[model samples]
Target: MAVTIEILIIILLIILNGLFSMAEFALVSARRIRLQQMLDRGEKGADIALSLSEDPNTFLSTIQIGITLVGILAGAFGGAAIAKELEGTFTVIPEIAPYAGIISLFVVVLIITYFTLVFGEIIPKRIGLVYPEQIAVKAAGSIVIISRIFGPINKMASLTTDAVLWLFNSHAPQDPVVTEEDITSLLEEGTQAGVFNEAEQELVQSAFKFGDREVTTLMAPRPDVVFLDLEDSFEENKEKILTSGHTRYPVCRGGLDSVIGVVSVRDLWSQMTAGEKPDLTLLIQEALVIPEHITALRLLELFRTATTPLAVIMDEYGSVAGIITLHDLLEAIVGDLSTVDEPDEEPGIIEREDGSWFIDGMLPAEELRLLLELEILPGENEGVYRTAAGFVMSELGKIPIPGDHFVLNGIRFEVADMDKRRIDKIIVSKIRHRGDENPDEKTDNHTTS
Candidate 1:
């Protein structure tokens, strides 16, 4: 009965060690935001868990004390009492009696260590990771009690740790900082867990990156911007109005380089409806002027503070670069929004049946990076370029002929079509592995746009 009591005491010690291990891992691994949320919801013990986590020195000292004391007591008591009992059993055999003391002590230590390693460490740590927040909260009160019981010892240990750090001129440990990547990771988790849909996730991500995008990337390029030329005949202006089917037009005096203001079809119609002539100059509204290099986010702020949403983008040389509207900025965040009475526009990217992709030269580099699963595009940091055409040009460092092709990170990019000096369209084959068949070379059969 006395031997049975000793064995039970060893078992109890192992269990206590396991609790210490569990509490340590749970508190360390639990997300502070999650613990705070639990506290906000009035969950018991969450506050203590959060508090303990904030003071790593105290919490670690408390957990180490429990684990160390349990280990020592279990080892000493278990090795002595169990080995003595086992030695008696072995001595019954005459041949084993001589080495029984040594053999029994070894066997007793081995059994105790195995149980301690599994029950007191690995298994508990795994369980703690599986439900860190809950386990941390549940274990917090007991840990606090233990910490208070041995407060002086833990305080001494922490003081010693601080003195050693002071010798090195180091600062105390700081709380982990939450960054944009952390929020993005949580958003991805929320997406997988069905709390957010893919589109919703993309919108949030786009909004986060909106401040980094340049105005030139979002504007309608000079060649694409239709205008109401004041010098043109009435029939010519009417043809521009009918053919473009757009709501707003920049009223230029001479050419695209010289812009006066913006005229809206709605403002023209309102004049005609009021029994007045649809005078172009009379209908022209003052448009906001912004530098082409401005970020889309700052432009948004400008729009918010301005009377009109239409803005004329000017390049460094004081030439008209492009035009932008509030709708364009909205599209950058939420994706393309087709205007009423217009057919659905073709997407910037289309994958062919042959596994090659037809990519528009005007496609944004950010979109290209995601499509290619690339870590980054060239000139991403310094804002050297914006579109895929700009990316291709920066890579080649010269004008590219229609047949020009190159490989990057195992993906083949070929200039499929060109419009004079500009890149009009590109054909991109999917990524190839090192050992896969060599990417087939293509002859340029496409026309010059």
Candidate 2:
């Protein structure tokens, strides 16, 4: 009986050793570099340890098989020895000896269970978690021998597990690398960890945010552009082009209503060498056109591959409404400033001290709402337009006119400038309070020109 108990304890210890080794493997695998670094510092034998640890499935199978075999060996030999001792001690009565043998076997089994469960499973797993690298190094030398002994059993177990997985329609190993959302999440984490400043973080976030942004948001609306009507004479067209100070102009067949193509000054210069009267028909090149709803990102790509700088944005009915350029897309990502010496014009709110707001129309609806300190502009149309003028124009049913004024949350906006065909510069001012009249408002002619 005593001999049986001793054997059971040895089996339990062997099982415990395997469990500890398994835990070490898991920890090293989970954090390979950390483990390797620790090993380099001479905590223990890291290279040999990590070899088994790196392959979790193999390590786990080997550990379980090794422990079980050891436990079975100890139990079988020890049980027989215990049974013999019990029979000798009880002597004489056959029934007494048999009963004593059974009791001894039960006790030995109970002891083995307690020792193996506590020391083998719980203790080592905990220690591995705390000092994984150290434990992994310690167990390095034994991992290979243990693996070899259990290789056949491990294969059988693996086959069974694979069969079960197949029955449930589980996927086989290889999964594709990185998703868009995953990349975004990683950026977000980097932001939180202070790896990115606010502007840099915003730039990354904007890349994802504006990838789906439509062409209309970045386009120069029709109202703000200077163009030559198809019927206009060559001299008249030349005058308009020179005065507009633009490198390119959109030429319509009849008027603004019949946009035919975009014509560049370079094209015009090339045509001048032909010595004809500079025919307007020959000046136009085919317009690279897209629906207004097409995303700016996609539009930018089309522009890149086509090698065209300008793309005409069209409405649902295929009428030219606006244009977007490569510069516009780039500015959307990094912002625009011609020189570093330029000062930031307005900080918090768009004040009425000056005639125009040097503000980005593409500023978020929430931000615009907060800056103006008004709730009149509902946050429903976020990311729809890039600027306040565009938002107002969209709200006003698209054909916003010059000298038109509207009140949003009691703030009055008068059209100050239109870039191309769209609202570009707007003068926003608060309405007069009941008791106090604004001095500037009264002097400046509240009547918008």
Best prediction by TM-score: 1
**How many clashing pairs per prediction, in order?**
0, 15
- Against the reference, the lDDT scores of all candidates come to 0.85, 0.65
- Residue lDDT tens for model 1, 1-449: 66788888988998898888988999999999999999999999999999988888888999999888997788578658778888988888899889999989899889988988898889999999999999999999988898899999999999999999899999865645687889899999999999999999999998988878888888888888888899998689989888888888889888987888888888888888999966898877888999988999999999988766789999889998999899889988998898883447678999999888899998888888889898887687678888898888777677898878676666778888898888989888865655532344332222222
Q: Where is model 2 more than 4 Å wrong at Cα?
A: 1-203, 273-276, 305-307, 337-387, 390-449
Q: What would the per-residue lDDT of candidate 2 be over residues 323-415, giving only the tens digit for each residue?
A: 777767887788664533223333423554643344444344444665667654643455555557656665555556666665554566666
Candidate 1 runs further than 4 Å off: 42-45, 86-111, 141-176, 341-343, 407-410, 430-449
**Error at 405, model 2, angstroms:** 11
TM-score of each: 0.82, 0.48
| Residue 113 error, candidate 1, Å | 3.6
